[model samples]
Target: MPPTHLRRALAVSATAAALTVPLLGAAPAEPAARVASAAPVVPVVPAVPVVPADVVDDYYADAEGLTGEPLKQALHEIISTDVTTLTYSQVWDALKVTDRDPADPDSVILLYTGLSRDADANGGNVGQWNREHVWPQSHGDFGTSPGPGTDLHHLRPSDVQVNSDRGNKDFDEGGTESPRAPGNYTDADSWEPRDEVKGDIARMALYMAVRWEGGDGFADLEVNDSTGNGSVPYLGRLSTLLDWHAQDPPSAAEEARNATVFEDFQGNRNPFVDHPEWVEEIW
Candidate 1:
């Protein structure tokens, strides 16, 4: 979480944190962010295998079937629940991939410098940096407005250019192939999801999908296109590339941003990043 100053800015609802989806054509100025590769140090825990597409459908089906406050409560439970023996802010911060000031709200810099030491043995990988949406603040999600506790899906750290290119557009098979889409919505220029980041995206999508599965029309943000079509079925349809992205993991800058955001707002760390083994389902 950020320091007091940044938190204050969030309270006013004027900063980016206060808005949900960006307006039409609204995109961050930078394009594909860079990511550096140091040594491929193996994870301490066993790798959480990506769920097969068919299995992913099972999870989706189960999540989709849920409705009403039951879905919302489940989602809130996921996001609001504190990881075992960890505070919410601590878990949230662990997943950040960007560098940010504990006190600044606009400094969500997704690149790494010589100063980063959290993820790398030799300080940090200065090359692996990318802009991560604190909340997959999709510009396409209608009626999005950052306020007290808004739905934050579509969040992930990726090449800045790729994310920029995807600005506010839904992941649809628009002749262009997008790695960001699930099998249903493929675009040529869509995000080519990394292994680690895919899972991260999945987690966010799952949270939203389950939460809004039963919301009223326009209120549903979770499951989308019940039949695996392109349109978001409800307000919380999970993004397709979540599993692949999570496997690839967010850049160091994104991890940092997650940390700062949690510290500033929810006051928790990102448990998934810190303890990758806890993840069971990733598509």
Candidate 2:
């Protein structure tokens, strides 16, 4: 489901944004019911039937010439404003997109152990669940227009501090310096990019940086630069770990847990977690 703020981003009709739902993880089956005790429930549409490979290829081709930030913009434009009547958030909300938590082993069993589900099982939140742009919006990438397909890249829910520390800088294997936001506290050493979720963060960041290469708004953002003050570290450890993760994806167990958590909270599926083949299989 799209955030309230994102819904406003697309002031036109709210049809598409309203359809988001969870993609991976453990969420209650009856989605419409409220969860006051938990994170606010954002309404969204159920998953669109997975498109056939040929259709997917066609869609990918349509998205061709789009990569880095420009590609992301293209995707955002398609979802939020391109359609005129349909907002990006509306589409995402109706679908339910979420990020996964590989830290929890039970996460997989709680949802689905593999791509195949049991008779009684279903996927968790992939929407509404935060697919954080490793490169932040503050730096100005796609302008927060949430939707499915190519737009989905550059997002992955992660620890708030982790996201804050990253702040649109590119993921580098070298150490990093402190953030310009002085109050932002990130103990580069304490920050563990090796953490299960870190891998997800790394891949998403790389994808976004490549997608938004030429967007006028993001040129100033130093995607791969350090703070220069020697406070952050050389390349952020998280950035380096992400490189490794992308080269070698998590194990089946990691995939399951991330998928489960994503399902429960956001309401959608992770193409990376679901189909490892989409990326190089080093891990």
Top TM-score prediction, candidate number? 1
For residues 1-283, write the lDDT of model 2, one tens digit per residue: 2223333433423332222222332322323443433322222223432223453344334345544445444443332322222244443332232221222211111111111112122223321122244454544434555322224443433323334555445344434333321212234432333323445555454444333444433332233434321222122333454455566564443343333322222222333444444333221
Give the worst 10-residue stretch by lDDT in candidate 1: 20-29
lDDT of 1 by residue, 135-219 (tens): 3334224333332124323333333444454443333223443332222233442333323234455444444444333323333
Model 1 vs. true fold: TM: 0.40
Error of 1 at 222 (Å): 2.7
Best model number under lDDT: 2
